[model samples]
Target: MHAHTATRPVALVTGAGRTSNIAAATARTLAAHGWDVAFTYYRPYDARMPWGAEEGAARALHAAITEYGARALGVEADLADPQAPARLMDTVADRLGPATALVLAHCESVDSGLLDTTPESFDRHFAVNTRAAWLLIREYALRLKAPHGAGRIIALTSDHTAHNLPYGASKGALDRITLAAATELAHLGVSANALNPGPVDTGWMSAEHARQLRSATPLGRLGTPQDCAHLIEFLCSARGGWVNGQLITSNGGLA
Candidate 1:
């Protein structure tokens, strides 16, 4: 189940919904490092978020990945659909090969508080942020090629709460479900972990929010998509093979 023609390993990255999203950064980084990439995007979801909609974001990212000279495939699928993950894997295997790594960075959320949140909204959030993520990891583990330590899974999470109730709760579920992948897929040579990149300025953070975050963080800088891509690169690398099942907070010492 490796690359179709035995080329460099392929990485299937979710949440690469836009050109500037974290998944895009991770895909670009992996491509630069000689890994082929397959990205999934949910355009309707991104369109509803404050970041606004994107036209051909997936195609643009695919072009960028190929610029690194690595084969790239972009699929416009909604992970919330449940069946999307399997189709994504199949497409990758058929087009780019087996994915050596899976990065879940897609999220669905709004600033609805507990009192304001409707049942439909809450369920929609979980459908994408939690349920879809769980399914993707399970499929990734099952499709992984042999050699126990070759599979890598990284789930992105957030620590923010308050008005972000649905996001907070669903991501918490995402963290726990993904952590189990380490033990559940360990015998199969897969390592799974979660990363919380708090307060990334992905167009939602207002200027005031950025100032507050920078002032509070020891590094005095906002977390960037590159920051996330850098950490993910390590986890997928051989040196990070032993790191598993833990929720690592890579927020530049946000205190």
Candidate 2:
């Protein structure tokens, strides 16, 4: 039941939904770099808000990655659950062996304004965006202490955190957690970091929002999933060994 053949390295990516999302791009990028990929998708019953109609998008992403001759497994889990991270790690270990790299890409909130955000919204964001990420990193660190070389843990954050957005504040907390975990895990051969993508052209942004963001960016264009994916790929590679406890922003100087 090993997810990949004994030869390939394993990578786990969370929040890999269908819509050309950052997680999807990261998965493909990792596969291209020769790592078997396993990603998580929230079940339809568990989706709290309308995530658009990208049916079977996760499956398509899995197929695309596997097409590159690497193994891909998609698991459906409720990230809001406190135990989800442990369960996810267990699933990955059972199906794909010990993961050498972990990507925490799951997010559950999209509230635009602070006034409109609810307590439930805050809790959900913290649970999925911050807490689960911490748990994943902890589990990965515990498993990597043996003589298998150092592992990588990359979590996604947002420029909104710098802009004082409520959801972004939660991400800020997640960033702090990453820093603390990185210091603790460094001794165990695990490097933890956060990737903050400024504005991406995901369908999540409205036309007006997209225009404003693009105009504000010095690059005159919004970020793309591939942009984030490339950085993630580099960080997960041997070359990124020295990068730990850093918050690398991938924005086009929009901040």
TM-scores of all predicted structures = 0.95, 0.90
Off by over 4 Å in 2: 1-6, 45-53, 145-149, 161-165
Runs with alpha carbons beyond 4 Å of true place in candidate 1: 1-6
Candidate 2 C-alpha lDDT tens digits along 181-204:
777876667788988888777677
Taking the candidates one at a time, how many backbone clashes does each contain?
1, 1
Candidate 2: the clashing residue pairs are 3-95
Check candidate 1 and list the clashing pairs. Answer: 148-189
Error of 1 at 17 (Å): 1.6
What's the lDDT for residue 108 in model 2?
65
Worst 10 residues of 2 by lDDT: 141-150
lDDT of 1 by residue, 59-113 (tens): 8898999998889988888877889888888888888767889999888878889
- Candidate 2, residue 217: lDDT: 91
